[model samples]
Target: MKPSIPPPPTQEDEALIKDYLLHRMLQTVLERDIQIFKTLELTMTNLYILNLQHIIKRMSDPYWTVKHQIRQRGIRIESKSWTPEGEIQVLYLCRGYQRSLLCSWPPMKEELKDRIISYLGTDLAAY
Candidate 1:
């Protein structure tokens, strides 16, 4: 008997897989950041801001086309409340949006920690 080949994935299947991978990647990034924050005494709000800045700086185009597109999709780029917890909440809300962009169009190869330091404009070696 000959072995049978599996059928190719449909568009729906592909979409589901893509969504799963995107969420998994976002979760992994968040977990790693939380662990680093624990050691560096960073708050959830700081993590949220760092991630937000990275997304804006890295994802936006000169014409603001990408930014506008994401905004149209109801992604929260700014925090509405003036509290750390609120910022953290916004961060969680932005996770799917960030991951969607990151998944469909990956940015340059840079670690989250390095990006955070760069965003802070601080020289770690000096510390």
Candidate 2:
């Protein structure tokens, strides 16, 4: 039998991991079609856990919650759906009129784009 593989972090590594997680999460939110105003509250524990299996076993399935900055000043959306790509649960702030930003992600179908436009609001150039 082969020796066991070591996990990524030691007990002492939590702080650096936590800081990196915060910065990355915020950056990811900002770089997307969403613009979050400020981060009022953030709990970094398990913030970067990408695997849904472990989340389903130990915690709530599709586990993620943003109560501080994102909810107070921005948008908070929660949904569970398995698309052709993968099962996903997403929470994000949406740009009500960012057209180019909408195209930045994977190319959505025209129907999807029209639906998104309807949901987000009109294509006002003022934004």
Q: Which ten residues in a row have the lowest lDDT in candidate 1?
A: 86-95
lDDT of 1 by residue, 17-125 (tens): 3333333344456567655665674456676656654644543342255334434444443331224322211221232333221222333123434554554577998
- Candidate 2 residue-wise lDDT at 87: 26
Cα error, candidate 2, residue 119 (Å): 38
TM per candidate comes to: 0.31, 0.21
Judged by whole-model lDDT over C-alpha atoms, candidate 2 comes out at 0.32
Q: Pick the candidate with the highest lDDT.
A: 1
Name every residue pair that clashes in candidate 2.
none
Candidate with maximal TM-score: 1
TM-score of 2: 0.21
